[model samples]
Target: MFLFIGLVLFGADRLLLLLESRGHVNWRRTGRRDLSAEPTARLDSLLEDPDRRPVRRP
Candidate 1:
């Protein structure tokens, strides 16, 4: 049972990879995701900034 499940998962992975190669799906990311480069929320921006005044919006 475990072997069958493993085979199915392996087959599915290969099929997805094939689809990704054909550009039918984005199964894998080409570039490494940079969390630091992502846009920060209002609260996070406020915490990171030196000024925490309500009047100031950056």
Candidate 2:
């Protein structure tokens, strides 16, 4: 029973991570944006490049 419970928890964790990757959830702590800080050079370049706009999902 304990093994089954552990498996279920593991599966749930994986599902949450998958959702986060697909922009359906916000559970991860890595690479979070700091809105108050100045934009980095890499970000600025990406923004200025008209051919590199991020695709929006429907």
RMSD of each: 7.1, 11.2
Query: What TM-score does model 1 achieve against the real structure?
Result: 0.49
Which numbered prediction scores highest in lDDT against the true structure?
2
What is the lDDT for 9 in model 1? 96
Give each model a TM-score.
Answer: 0.49, 0.48
Which digits, one per residue and each the tens of the lDDT, describe model 2 over residues 18-54? 9988888777644766876966567676568766778
Which predicted model would earn the best TM-score? 1
> CA lDDT of 27 in candidate 1?
77
lDDT per residue (tens digit) for residues 4-53 in model 1:
99999999999998998887887764455588999878887657765555
Off by over 4 Å in 2: 30-58
Candidate 2, residue 50: how far the Cα is off, in Å: 44
